[model samples]
Target: MVQLYNNGAYLLNGTEIIEDNSEANAKLATKLGANVISKDEAATGTIAYGILEKHNTSGNMDKLKIKFDKLTSHDITFVGIIQTARASGLEKFPVPYVLTNCHNSLCAVGGTINEDDHMFGLTSAKKYGGIYVPPHQAVIHQYAREMLAGGGKMILGSDSHTRYGALGTMAMGEGGPELVKQLLSKTYDINMPKVVGVYLTGKPQKGVGPQDVALAIIGEVFANGYVNNKVMEFVGDGVANLSADFRIGIDVMTTETTCLSSIWKTDDTIKEFYEIHGRKEEYKELNPAHITYYDGMIYVDLSKIKPMIAMPFHPSNTYTIEELNANLMDILADCEKKALVSLGGAVDFKLRDKVRNGKLYVEQGIIAGCAGGGFENICEASDILNGASIGSDEFTLSVYPASTPIYMELVKNGCVAKLMGAGAIVKTAFCGPCFGAGDTPSHNAFSIRHSTRNFPNREGSKLQNGQISSVALMDARSIAATAANKGYLTAATDIDVEFTNPKYFFDQTIYENRVFDSKGVADSSVEIKFGPNIKDWPEMPGLTDNLLIKVVSEIHDPVTTTDELIPSGETSSYRSNPIGLAEFTLSRKDPEYVGKAKAVQAAEMARRENKSLQEALPEIDVIINKIKDNYSDVNNINTGIGSVIFAVKPGDGSAREQAASCQRVLGGWANIANEYATKRYRSNLINWGMLPFIIAKEELPFQNGDYLFIPEIKKAVEEKQSEMKAYVVGNSLKEFTLKLGELTDDERTIILKGCLINFYKG
Candidate 1:
């Protein structure tokens, strides 16, 4: 259903695609009557380039320094972002900021911790001239879509699925430090990213929803890294075929493809979306120029797409439901094998046991979060289950509308009644299901979800405790179909049901009555509320002349998600407190990571206090003596001690800064990986003042518990050296090289100062 172009291509008059070959220039010239633009000029003709150009303030296209039009964060992230900004001398919000309490809406964990965060958000909005959406009102992205998204505008959010391209807004989801930068009136610095054209044609089939199309695209591109760190600009005649919610369902899931951001060519469909939301003036016509070029193109034929599923452990492990059922045992066996790698044998994960009578059975189904909670997806799901019952079985179904307004409309249009009548429990607006906070299944149970990710432990199973469950991603229609069957996995196509597509009506009164809008007015006399659990960040030391890093953990997983780096769900309650949250760092993956890192941190603490490092950490004497063999000047005063972790490719999922900051606060100084999975993760490491060390993908020079010494590490970073030498403090000090990727000058300063908070303190 998806075809990837191997090379650059040209779009003529937005109607045709001509591959960049020998005849490309001639074809373009023929179409434009002897007028053909250069590749560089045509590159500027994309919708992505235009939106970026409008926001870029660096005056140089090669390097972008962007100041976004707005900023947003959810409860799990806003507290920390505001705390960081407050520490960095934030007087007032430089741009419009919205704090939505959806991630931690369920105040069931850690007592009053979640509600205290809500109060903090409300007070911070009043004190700093921002906006605050109360819990159960709306999830972050849905609220932004209904209010904040504007055509030809740029928005930055703290959640990874922060895409609004279908609304003509170029929004990026980065770690909280980036939002803090905006709060401090600093610019977001990055190199100009490549733009890829996602040219869609043909309409989707009756049973195929946007999730099917999204999974199809993700399955094709995620493994090969075709659109990594690049913008996916959707452009084609098929754009006119989908409704606003259909396009949104596909756009929000672009985060799964590892793309930087996405933008769509807007038409009357998108304009109507704005008008429905009561922001008609924000709608602006956006389209690529007549002659536009893309570095690559992904051609998607929606009509050919089938009802799809991404098997347990990842969103990229995709197959059609028909294909899966025909070869149930084989696919289940393969998924079990993959689970061994993902779970590390912590629990006995078996999917074959879920098969009954040659058909796969799932225990739970969820249609929630930004991807599935849209009105159209839920309406179609309600239609598919108009008069059917979910039955009293192991299978349970729950639906959560993305926003209160959607819930109101669903109630108004009787979709809620139909869903409730069929035994589906409808909840308020919350992102818990998407990130492991809700709907946890029993051990060995299988779940079918319409959420964004299906990663390990992302379904709320604690593998370290010998408990595990798995989730398979499907569309809302398929999930509802499965629920209607009570337990048996079924595709919407197998059940012949007429969909009563209903019109949506937006209601703004709910938000107006419940939400706290500062109206861009700050009250200097207002006191910022502080919860007892909230804690300030611990002091961090700047980079020393030399470094000694102990490799505490070694992971060979092809890719390590942020969830592995620092888990979500229950741990989200500790997010506002830095040191308290660090205790859970790598708790699920390594279990011993925190203890090992703390031992290394103790040596650094001794060094900082001018105490005997040998007495504090008994084993440090031998390693320091061996390091002294090469450089006699290396001493406790000139060298720093810390820990590191080596993974094949780390930081794949989530834009949460804690993935890197948790490591930082626990005495981690560097990360050794073959490569990083996403730009946002690398940025998180940099913002946290951790060295993003890149080792070649060959056999390692050191193993876990090996102390590696890097002399003059600070000097190398200051000199902008691409590569550095490191020695394993063993019998003979085995040597190896580590590479540092591109870093801006400001980034170098942040490293030198220890972190963004320190950089701004100066």
Candidate 2:
């Protein structure tokens, strides 16, 4: 159903694809009748290029410095972003900033800390001239889609799923520091990324939903890095066939492909979407120029897509429902094997045990969050479960609308009644299910969710506590079908049900009554609320002339998600406090990482206080003596001591800065990895003054607890050196080279100055 182009391709009038092969350029010239089209000129024809050019503040197109029209964050992130901005001499929010309380709205954990953070957000919004959406009103991306998205405008958010490309707006999900830059009137610096063309054709089949198409694309592109760090520009005839909501479902999952951002060819469907949300003036016609060139192309035939499901452990472990059902035992065996690597054998995970009479059964089904909570998805799910019942067994179902307006419309159309009548509980708009803060399943339970991720511990399971569950990602339609089957795994296509396709009616009064919008007017006289758990960042030292770092953790997993670095769920309640949250760093993946990192941190603290490192950490004397034996210049005062982690691939999921910030607060100075999985994660490392180092060899040169001494490290970053030499300090010292990929000048400065906060402090 999906095909990837291995080479560059050209889109003719947004429909025909011409592969840039041996004679394609000559053929293009002949078709255009002697008109020479430069690649740069053709690039400007893409919708993404047009939007990016409008937001580019740098004079040169090659090196873009972007200033977004607006900014957004959720409660889990806004606190840290605001704290960083405030430390950097923030006068007022330069642009419209929306802080939504969706991640930690339950206030069920950490006593009153969650609600205290909400109050802090409200008062901060009032004092800084911003907007704040209260809990249950809308999730972060939903609020942005309903109110902030505009045609051809660019928006930056602190959530990974921040995508509004279907609305003809280019939105990116980055770490909080990027938003802090925009808040401080600084530009987001980067080299212009190549754009990939996603040419769609044919309408989807009856049972196939937008998540099916998205999963198919993600499975095809994720492993091969087809669209990694590139803009995905959707085009072609199929654009008109899908509704605005369908396009949104597919767009939000684009983060799984690791793409930078996305934009689409807008039509009346999008204009009607804006009209339905009472923002018709934001609509504008956006399409590819007559001829557009792309670095790559992904051609998708929507008609052939099947009811798909991403098996446990990752969103990319995809298989059609038919295939999975046909080969249940074999697939379950494979999943069980993979679970060992993901779960670290903490608990015995068996999907086969859930199978009864050759059919797999799930305990829970959820159609919630930004991916599944849209109006059409919920209406169709309600239709599927209209008269059917989710049996009174262990199986249960819950539905969450994307926003209060969607919930209101669902109630008005009687969908909520139908769902409740069928034993499904309808809940308010919340992101807990998607990020593991709510609806935690029982031990060893299997949950089918239409959420963003299915990573381990993302379903609120604590493997360290011998509690492990699994989540398989499926479309809302199929999830509803499964619920109707009373937890027996069933695809929507297996059932014969007609969709109601009820029309959506937005209730603006719901937002007007609950949301607090500053309307860009700041009141300096307002007193900012400060919660006890909300603490300022600790002081960080600048890069030293020489560095000594002990490898605290070594993870050989193919990819380590942010949840593994620092867990979600209850840990989110402590996100406002850096040190409080840092205690959980690598708690899930490496339980002893915190103690190891803190030991190194204590040494650095002693150095800053002009105390003996041996006095602080008695174990450090052995490594320091080993280093000084060979290199006479090495000393406690000259060498900065910290910890580092080596992973095969890290930073695969989420845009939370805590993954890196937590490590930085714990005295982590660098991360050595084979490669980084996402741009946002690497940016987090840079913004937090952590060296994102890459090793070429698959075999690691140093082991855990081995100290690596690098001389003249600060000078190397200042000199723009790509490669640096380091020596393992032990009985027999061994040297290895590490590479720092291309970094912008500002990024280099941020590292040299300690952090973004320190960069501005200077």
Clashing pairs in 2: none
TM-score of 2: 0.99
lDDT of 2 by residue, 1-762 (tens): 999988888888777899889988888988786665887788888998888889999988899999999999999999999999999998899999999999998899999899999999999999999999999899999999999999999999999999999999999999999999999999998889999999999999887899999999999999999999999999989989999999999999999999999999999999999999899999999999988899999999998999999999999999999999999999999999998899888899989999999999999999999999999999999899999999999999999999999998999999999999999999999999988889999999999999999999899999889898899999999999999999999999889999978888887888888888889999988888988999999998889988999999999988999999989999999999999999999998999999999998999999889898898999898888888788888876778999999999899989999999999999999999999999999999999999999998567889998899998999999999999999988786799999999999999999998999999998
- Give me the runs in candidate 2 sitting further than 4 Å from their true place: none
| C-alpha RMSD in Å of predicted model 1 compared with the true structure | 0.8
What's the lDDT for all of these models? 0.93, 0.93
Which regions of candidate 1 deviate over 4 angstroms? none
lDDT of 1 by residue, 1-762 (tens): 899998989988888999998988788778886688899999999999999998999999899999999999999999999999999999999889999999999998999999999999999999999999999999999999999999999999999999999999999999999999999999999899999999999999897899999999999999999999999999999999999999999999999999999999999988888988888999989999999999999999988999999998899999999999999999999999998899898888899998888888899999998999999999999998899999998999999999999999999999999999999999999898888999999888898999999998888989888889889999999998998898799999899999888888998898899999998999978898999988888887899999999999999989999999999989999999999999999988999999999999999999999999988899999988888788889987999999999999999989999999999999999999999999999999999899999999788999999999998999999999999999999977898999989999999989988999999999
